[model samples]
Target: MDRKRVNACIEEIVKARKADGGLKQVFWVAAGGSNGGFFPAQYFMDRESKSLRSQSFTSNEFFLAPPSSLGKNSLVILCSMRGTAETCDAASLAKERGATTIALYIEESKLTEVCDYSFAYESISYDETEASEMNASYGLFLAMVLLKKLENYEHFDLAIESFSVLDRVYRDAWNYTLPLAKKWAERNKNESVIWVLAGGPAYGAGYIFSICNLEEMQWISSPTVNTCEFVHGPFECTDKNLPMFILISEGRTRPADERVLAFLKKHTDQNIYVLDAKELGLSRIDKRVSEYFNHLLFSPILNNVYLRALAIAKNHDYHYRRYMWQEKY
Candidate 1:
């Protein structure tokens, strides 16, 4: 929560990139939930910025098959809650290749030491306490600031101002959504399989919820598929008793989500839980900016909080794991 330090670090990055032929590309490098958090930022840059090309890669893949686009004018951002070995190796490689490296971590470790710039946020921890939502928010803020500096984005000020009151928004969202989450958990506690669907930036939320929370934490069968890709093959698996969760983004691809929702409703007698970003009252945020960035701000927190409630209802602990931190990979 050291806003001043974060600002200073971003300022230095901006200054350095400006001096080094004006930052041609940005790579968000990490793995698992950490890499999932970067998706919204990549989506934002793709939609809003013209000059800066943004992409995300898992640490293992980046280390084995380095991108041809990575070079002196590239800004590489690596994130890890615990600063895992793969992340550290990837950061070291990117640094050695002359890319400007920034490490965002919850705790100090080897990855932090290898980067040109490092940021540690005490409020965002690498645990099963539903804190990854806050971590994603911080990630989006850092990405937005970088984009603002590079492109002079018109809506950056409003976005930052809105985020200043995000604590209150988060509280309100939890209060409003917790009851619904609990109800869904109670009803579906015995279900064997679940399908999660999302499109656009909200895909990150779906990925983390299905993979990190449901599958990894609760040991459930939850396969996340993009709404646009549902009809290709995944949609055929739907049945009357199956459970589905849909995360609807408020951006350009919302119509695609709506199309899938309508199809599911018409074809299946199963329960379909829809958590739409438009329902959250982001009172302080501008409507235009909210439409574009609300998925990054709202979806992860909602899904994280909902998954916590599901864990409770299923008589499972969110922190319980078979191999995650209990054994070495």
Candidate 2:
């Protein structure tokens, strides 16, 4: 991947926005893993940009009831690993509505043909889990570009530098997580149901792992809830024998997650598994950026890898799916 080219493309988009008196809104549209990948970026924009409005939507939802705010002064980002039919239709709708559309994908397809700008990453023989993480990285880049234009986004340079070294960071994260993943898998292999929890940016990681990887791929019953929401009602579902997985973010939301963890430890005798991003030694990543983005970057990828281990431990292939590409949905 040429970092220079990515930067250039971002600059082009920024220049266009400036020439048009600036973009008023941004929409992130996708489905399944791709929709999951948009969460952190959406979070970043919400937290960092004061002037730009951003929203995320499932591809079909966007096409069915398009936002009234979407127009020539809006930017719409679409994602599709294989360019799904729904996403392609949404991109075409976005373009027809006069929004500056950008498609981030791994291949050239209907999505690329419909968008005003398309960025394609090198195609790899990676499963949906791996592709989700890769797409998240691309989404983060898009977020940063918009952030740079909306506000100076003080940490932009450091964030880009940190992203460039994520390959190494991912390796270290996997090395640290492997044994733990295997152990967790062994304990939960026979369990009928499990719960996953996270807060803030890490919520996306928890959601995707539980829904896309565990439930969808492994045919396990898993429910994911925001950590902050745990105490409201979901706490009633906890018990001594239940299994729970918690993803602890390293950012401001850490306290929210810690509060949930403390309550769970004190109240339930259930088996609990926790993965904290701060503990992952991601070399070369900026400390502050790591605090904000590590949970988003590390948790999902690590969870995917962990699921693969769990699949192997249970004598099941992670790629096994009932209705994924094998059957019509």
Candidate 3:
């Protein structure tokens, strides 16, 4: 909703470029529900970043794990929109271990003070609960800025254009998916558990942030799966009454996707939902560009949509900033 804040964060990241001293590795850490899940995916797929190594860490016990875990020359980018204490503690530890520390927080806070550098997006809070959406968008901006600093972006203009495209996509998704997502939430309310499916990178995505956070939010059992695995094994004896959500990305996976759709059709008794940019007819991209963005940004957007719907369904009155800090540090 606040494009200016997102743009400002992006600009700061671009301006902060220093020769990363032959950067070798990166530890991209995020705390919170959706961010913890999506940040790693964003970091890895971002070819512009000089991150030879990357991983997502969740457990507090591992937060202090030796910096050598990321290798000698690692840059620790601690991401927490709400400036969670555990993440601040992790940043402090990473810095003490001689790893360069950076933080992406919603505002300048204690976490920023603990890091070598801090990027604040959305300084003026909107609705405290949904602020994470803004925080997530700012995180994406941070990723883009980091790339601009580290890589020779012949496509800087293109990247800016891509932001506009992304904004439009989010708007469209908000319009179209909300009603359907709410409907699905209603239909699946009685189910004891929900299965979320995506494949390949999306497979990694299925477990990354959103679904896992949804588990915490809804207090319902949610398991993520790669559609390929579901077809290989789980699909064999799935009961009709089960609920599963499929996140489809555009690519050669099309044929495989057809197979999935066919299978879901065959098992019409199962409560199933598909979230995809192309499937939703929401993205504006040429074929080549479509394939690329779909592979990267598509699932995260879908995940956001699902999260928003889940928040509404649960009547948690979810305020993003309310959960700003986790107590476990």
Candidate 4:
């Protein structure tokens, strides 16, 4: 990631602020896995920003019907792994609307070219860099930097301090989760549906794990529900034999997740595979802002370690798609 470019882009936006106002709203626009990756950012800005509001939009939705509030005072961050058509079009529309656009993508393509600012958070050589850098981490960092500039976010320094030890936290998570993920794969390799539950900052990890890793990559049936909302109606599906993968976030909403877990543990069989931030050595980062890093800590374990093991157990290639890239949808 080019920290200098990111700083410069946000700096320019703040410097050119019109006398009328500063930034008012932010639109996190993307599709599929990329859209899910923005959830942490949406959650962060939703909680942190006092002068600004934030919303997430699937790419075509933004292209077809962007918010009326999307004007010069708005900022739109669009992401796509390969710069897909829908996302590129959304970036174009955002640019046409006179909003400052930031494109987060792994490679340069049409979307990057059209947006006002572009950051390649990861590249072909991303694996050679720190284990902490991830697509979701980029989204969160953008929010952190923007908030630091606008509101002088109280925990800003602590947040940056958190980043420094993320590679450490990530390594610890991997070492701890490796044996557990292997066991998870062996357990759930044959299950038809493995429900995933999480909320708050950790929601994105669950989203990507369910939709992107399990369904899209593994061809498994995995539906996700926010932990806080599971009790409202989804609780009816609970059964002793039902398999679940519950991720516990360290944020304020953790109690809500705990409530969901408590009910599931009693009603369901011992099939609830769990990963908690408290289990990982995330204490190296300050607790004050540790919530923001939960997804980052959970991501590689979910997508890289667990799902890859599941793929091997099922004798399926993670990159193989029966329908997706093979056809023109």
Candidate 5:
């Protein structure tokens, strides 16, 4: 684990936050990589508090909610790996509109100047989790700490306990996923894209996991399809050669997994990578409690690990900041 880098990043966020007043009354905004996991971490703070909210936007894009309750009482804590135009534009807008801007990015580029305070993790290096992966994990944990300090949640102890379980789940899951990742690397066979399917709590996870375009190791496009949408339209076109990867996490959305698997079976010709939760063999089920949080938190952790392993399997350097050149929006 890059604890030194992680600790430094956490300390930077805390220090920058202190300089900008404090995080107790701020909106932690994140898009792109951490959008899946860290966003939920921010959202963990009860919505009624008027102190926290996570802004989620379209793929390859970042959005600013119309200046509502956020202008006066809130500051913007934006996270981006590459510091692309989408993130830069959003941060610029937030800063312009009187929001104290704080950025958690991998490289200190344009965003560093635009933001009032910037915490760039210069130590994480290229062949690791980079931006999204690290940001997601850190974002959630940081959000929890901030919320506990500010918000008056009675179940704080339980929440923290549950949160601690997430790391073990990811580590356990990686054990099983490593072999699958290797298989995906050895047998990709020039496949251009990988379709990831999920809905409910895993819906957001599916979206982020599917859209890992920032990593340059594999030109593999990951598009998340609505479980129902696949049955209606994309299912007909998919064949054995064109495979899709489905994320099956256990929860209320378990039924969606069955439907997705059934559909895949019907289209047996297409290559299918089923990233099931059981296969991951996570150590604790407590981490699996929140469909929303787990998908965002755990999935990215798994992704960062896989991204590193995949890069190694293919002998390529892995860095999100370097891949920023190709991001158009």
Candidate 6:
């Protein structure tokens, strides 16, 4: 994951911040799954950084109306897999605004050229389940490293050490989750619609599966419901005719997820497939930072097992696209 390169960039940011005393704001900009990838970093900065302000924006929106506070002391991070044109332009705009820009991409492209520094997450060049190299993991790591360097986070040492064991823990999680993922896919593969529910860090994984995996890849009508927002309006569709893919994350907002889960089980007859984070046994991660990593733990299950099985069962290849590259928007 190029931890050394990430460390160098954060050091450089620290140096720049010290020179001007203006490293208070961070903006995460990207599109689609790449935008989802930076959610953890924004959430982390919101929860942990006492002096830092963070925001996440879809690339086009960022280009259209950037925050007025986005200059000098700000850090703009643009993430993408192929470095889509919109995101690359966003990187250029960020650079032009005098913000220190970083591009977190799976590969180097024109977007990387526009940034002050580029770090590869290596999502494509990885095998099986690259625990420390997932999209969200890299963002979280960068946040951790930045906070650790900037403010001397007490548990950062243990959290950094935990990465050494994450791959092994990830393998165990994959093995444990595979059977249930396959079971859920086999039982509900023919369902016409699905409500994918998640909360906290795992929300991005649910977002990816619903938008990128189910709707875009398998041509299924899948809408994502945040567990925190489920009771507001989405819970109205609580009948036996509907199916739900519920994710119970292990993090700050887990109680919200649990509350919605309890309500769903009691009031609805819908076929519910729950992927509880507790069952994944992520004890190998340091307790101080474990909760922040629920997204990484849930990713392999969603990507390789649940989503893949459903695509196979529905006779659709995940790579198939109707109009993504074939038609203009």
lDDT values, one for every candidate: 0.78, 0.79, 0.57, 0.84, 0.58, 0.82
Per model, state how many residue pairs clash.
Answer: 0, 0, 7, 1, 7, 0
Top candidate when judged by lDDT against the true structure: 4
The runs of at least 3 residues in candidate 3 whose Cα sits more than 4 Å from the true structure, single-residue gaps closed, are: 1-21, 34-37, 40-51, 59-64, 67-72, 122-133, 136-156, 200-213, 251-259, 286-329
Name the lDDT of candidate 2.
0.79
Cα distance off (Å), candidate 4, residue 301: 1.4
lDDT of 5 by residue, 1-329 (tens): 24345445445555566665654355555555545544455445443245545454432343544446444335566777767666777777777666667677777777788987666543223333323245654555555555555555455465556545655565555565667677765665355666777765556667666665322345567667877566778777677877676777666666877887887787693578776665554324444334434564446544565555556665556553444566553
Model 5 regions lying over 4 Å from their true place: 1-31, 34-39, 42-54, 58-70, 82-86, 107-133, 142-151, 213-216, 267-270, 287-293, 296-329
Residue lDDT tens for model 4, 207-294: 9889989999888898988998999999999987889999988879999889999998788758998888888876667778888888
- After superposition on all C-alphas, the RMSD of every candidate to the true structure, in Å, is 2.6, 2.6, 5.1, 1.6, 5.8, 1.6
Clashing pairs in 5: 36-296, 37-296, 37-297, 210-222, 239-270, 240-269, 240-270
Q: Write the per-residue lDDT of candidate 6 for residues 94-206, one digit (tens) a residue.
A: 88888999888777899988898877775722465477887777888888888888778777888778776777877887788777777887888788898899988788878
Model 6 local distance difference test score: 0.82
**After superposing candidate 4, which stretches have Cα over 4 Å from the reference?**
123-131
lDDT per residue for candidate 1 within 176-230, as digits (tens), equals 8878888989988888788889888788878888888788877889998999899
In model 3, the Cα lDDT at residue 88 comes to 78
- The global Cα lDDT (0 to 1) of model 4 is 0.84
Error of 1 at 97 (Å): 0.5
> Any runs in candidate 6 off by more than 4 Å, and if so which?
124-126
Q: Compute the lDDT of residue 60 as modeled in candidate 2.
A: 98
The candidates, ranked best first by TM-score, are 4, 6, 2, 1, 3, 5
Q: TM-scores for all candidates?
A: 0.91, 0.92, 0.73, 0.96, 0.69, 0.95
| Candidate 1: stretches off by over 4 Å | 122-133, 296-300
